[model samples]
Target: MREDAPVWELEAATFDADHTQALAARLGEQLQAGDLLVLSGELGAGKTTFTQGLGTGMGVREGIISPTFVLVRIHPNLPDGPRSGGPDLVHVDAYRLGSAAEIDDIDLENTMDSSVTVVEWGEDRVEHLSDSRLEIALVRSEGAAVTPAGDFHHNDPKDAGGRDGVITDFDEDDDNEERLIRITAYGERWAGRKPDLSVD
Candidate 1:
């Protein structure tokens, strides 16, 4: 699902480690200061992987690992980009947040006006922090056990025959690989005089 405004979805059959880095790089190319990215998905859904790509693309300090225990990690940008104006990246993990009030203690909104903030597990809790945000939803699909080229045979031995080559399709089918990354430009630029986020 996608909209010219502010919501979309991305689907994939598998999420290898390489895809994580690639996603980040692609996002970095489109990012700028004051951008807020809110991520929502189940565990092992590649939230951190996406961030890694974004970090690399932005020329941020290497090793943009998840700040699970610490709740947040700040990656500073190098001074060699087109414009290095503020702190590079402010990465936040809102999964451990006990209550809505805890969000204020993080004090991320103060930085949103100048930095790119990526919040993991911040679906509903962090929307108040910024009116303008990019929401990403990732869904994993189950693909075929065997390939048309006959490389990977059927998973079920009973279905591995010669005459029929009986392919008892598993409930989980292999789907195409695609990342549904939705970018919503809200606020004034989107439809009003005063926008929540200003790209310029």
Candidate 2:
């Protein structure tokens, strides 16, 4: 609940979108309903790509897309499908949310207990939604900056409201950027448990 909260963290690097998705899929297998995943990353850090993998592992229905403009997207569990018993995926984009009060305005507590909630760009906004949560940060490695060199990000839209966070300022046409992801487990929900991050 505090900044010095009970926590344990691990670091893993992903070389591509596939690796990011694979890593998240592994975690998805271990998660259950009422779990919260907080994702932090600059634009183009594969947040959506990672969430897609999570949905796949959780056995949710397809069509996992960025909820930036839509704000929230719920991918329900697939009936009679693989991982059909898994929980639904509730993806929330908090990039435009300016405060905790705003996050509460959406009434997340209503569905969090029955769904796997993942919040993108929710570094400090949605931590209180649960007693324990998985805080994941995806960082672009050096030489892999989101903004290409010599390109000033004047009037960056992230500062503006109502964005989906799927667009990037950098060109990935020939660039293969690696992302460093750090996952931290907090509260009693994850106590004494170490995730087996065996992503192949």
Candidate 3:
């Protein structure tokens, strides 16, 4: 975190499908071609949800789903009208990878100049691909009590009914469910000291 780097934090009261769309709309306005976004979070942490918002904001194909099974999905803008500056979006999911080398086999770097490349589960391994990049990490707060008990398996004794059965109350400090998102700007395009923008 550079002292001068523009950064802002939002304490999302609740992390749900709508928050994902809002974040995307905010970020979509600030992005341009040749930018890379690295997203990291655990399963069901809403990485895909955020990307869905981004896709909607970027004017790429709508209904951008997680590429977990497809590996990569390219959302191209329709060329029907007078759209001159629209850029394609490339969504990649690297959860199945064992190492950085495996990610390289896909040659994602080559697409940066032509599209906004977003990699889900891409932190640690994909940052070097660009001189400028954005990293987003998401975490859920336990003190907030946002998770519904129904979401957990009732049969598990750890989650057994009574208040006494609860091992530990979900606290932001104690629970690992908090969501954190980091966006970094890299490359010559972002080297001019522009405001760190969320793009909304």
Candidate 4:
């Protein structure tokens, strides 16, 4: 079997959704047009949350949501932002796509050169679209409970309350769940310009 290609990797620990987004935002500042980001992770792993940060950092219009049903959503850069002359943000959810041909059908190449395309659940399926891409994987840290995407739910009421029947704010405790994020850069585009993941 062929070994995996050499890659630039960075491991980060993020607490809560906001922290994950902040990290992504820092990374987004380093991105430019024609960039492809492949995000791989399980459900409720903060994939969309990260994209939200990227959009914000890119100075795209607000309201960045998961394009689960629509399959793809485009957010244009602000007219006067730093990315004004750069590409737009193309957020894609490939969870429903069955093959790479289906991704090709989207004709992403049309905007590939002028946009930062981010594909969720697009690990093996979308690599063919670009020779160089950034691959990000988010995983829940050990002992951390999984939180729903975009929304939070309380844990067991019993756990939140003592025998005296006092209600506690689960959000405080739940927000501490840390996520292990791995970023890998592939191909020549990232040869000398690997993202600086040192930022907290």
Candidate 5:
């Protein structure tokens, strides 16, 4: 089904973590169940910060930390929140997963229809998860890197075959940092639909 869907992309520049989150919130308002977001970027590039914004836009419960230790965390939508109604947020960390098989081992399909799944460090390993998905890559400005919430020096992102940054926890305390966020939608699920990513 994705083969017929034309791939389209949107790019934006953010001056701080909150700015990045605000943009993600706009995109998050457009997402629903069966949606998948695969994040890719270097360390401290604001992946976690972006997810936090999605939670806000989706009206999910607060405290959306990175799934570093637990590997997976679910944030259910709130009845009294901003959006009022939406699917839960399924946050996943694919850093330790070396292959697609490992990704399947987590059994995400159980909630695939009930939640919006987001995976960090899933650049090359999440194509099979869904026929249609949103692939987001964050490029941080040089000399503006912030410290990741988790200690993730396992492998240098610059030398890891150009895969992506390691999975780390959410960091909301980072100083002003510029990030170029590119969002690409694939598969027929997004056919004829253009999302509004404009945010203040």
Candidate 6:
């Protein structure tokens, strides 16, 4: 929890989409304006699903869909006064970008100080924007099975410690996969306090 520590890690396991969203909501509770979360995971690894939970937790407008085709989507908070006085949500999808410069071209810094920016496929590309961002890497569990409809099925019972097994790399085209989410916090913004990823 040292402020100067290079990185601090927290891990969690999610059995299904509902569990994954619940976990994201917990993390969202700790978020505030000026926060940046860089997400990395294969397609169908629940990146967009997690963001949906985050937006809901933040009390932002609904319909938080993937920004893949559009590249970025902004969700303004309700005026009723949300956590930390209604910070906006800036969701970005960097999968189609060729370089970090393209991210800069989006003028995200203009809104960085007042919005919680969550970038998918932005691990290496978006780090330059903030030194105090969170890096979340998700993987599908090996025990995940395929359903008759050709979708992945994860029926493992919930594990309290969220440390069922080692997570490995996965295919981008995999569908309906269960995820093992690893979150790493960097810089003083997240020094002592860590997001609670435990499912509620």
lDDT of 5 by residue, 22-109 (tens): 8889888989899999998766777888999999889999998879888899999999888777899999999888999988999999
Candidate 3's clash total is 29
- When 2 and 4 are scored with lDDT, the better candidate is 2
TM-score of each: 0.66, 0.82, 0.68, 0.80, 0.81, 0.80
- lDDT string for model 3 (1-200, tens) is 45324233222323455655665655765678888888866666667777877777677777688888888899886565223367888999988876788789988867879999989988777766776776666555444444321122113222322332222333323222333343444455556444323322
Q: lDDT tens digits, residues 1-200, model 6?
A: 45434456665667677777777877787788999999987777888888988887888888998998999999998887456476899999999998999999999999999999999999779988887988887777776542221122222223323434435455545535567776777888977776655554
Better structure of 2 and 6 per TM-score: 2
Which window of ten consecutive residues has the lowest lDDT sum in model 3?
148-157
How well does candidate 3 match the true structure in TM-score terms? 0.68
Among all windows of 10 consecutive residues in model 1, the one with the lowest summed lDDT is: 146-155
User: Could you tell me the TM-score of candidate 4?
Assistant: 0.80
lDDT of 2 by residue, 81-188 (tens): 678778899999999999888999999889999999999998889988998898877766655334222221223222332223333466533224666666777788
* Collision count for each candidate, in order: 12, 1, 29, 0, 1, 0
- Candidate 4: list runs displaced more than 4 Å: 1-4, 144-176
Of candidate 6, the 10-residue stretch with the lowest lDDT total is: 146-155
Question: Which residue pairs in model 4 clash with each other?
Answer: none
What value of lDDT does candidate 5 attain over all alpha carbons? 0.77
Better of 3 and 5 by TM-score: 5
lDDT of 4 by residue, 1-200 (tens): 11235345555677678888887887788888999999977777778888998987788878998899999899999999866765689999999999999999988889888899999999878898888898888766665443433232223322422223212223322433567676777778876675654443
- Report lDDT (Cα) of residue 113, candidate 6: 95
lDDT of each prediction vs. the true structure?
A: 0.59, 0.77, 0.62, 0.75, 0.77, 0.77
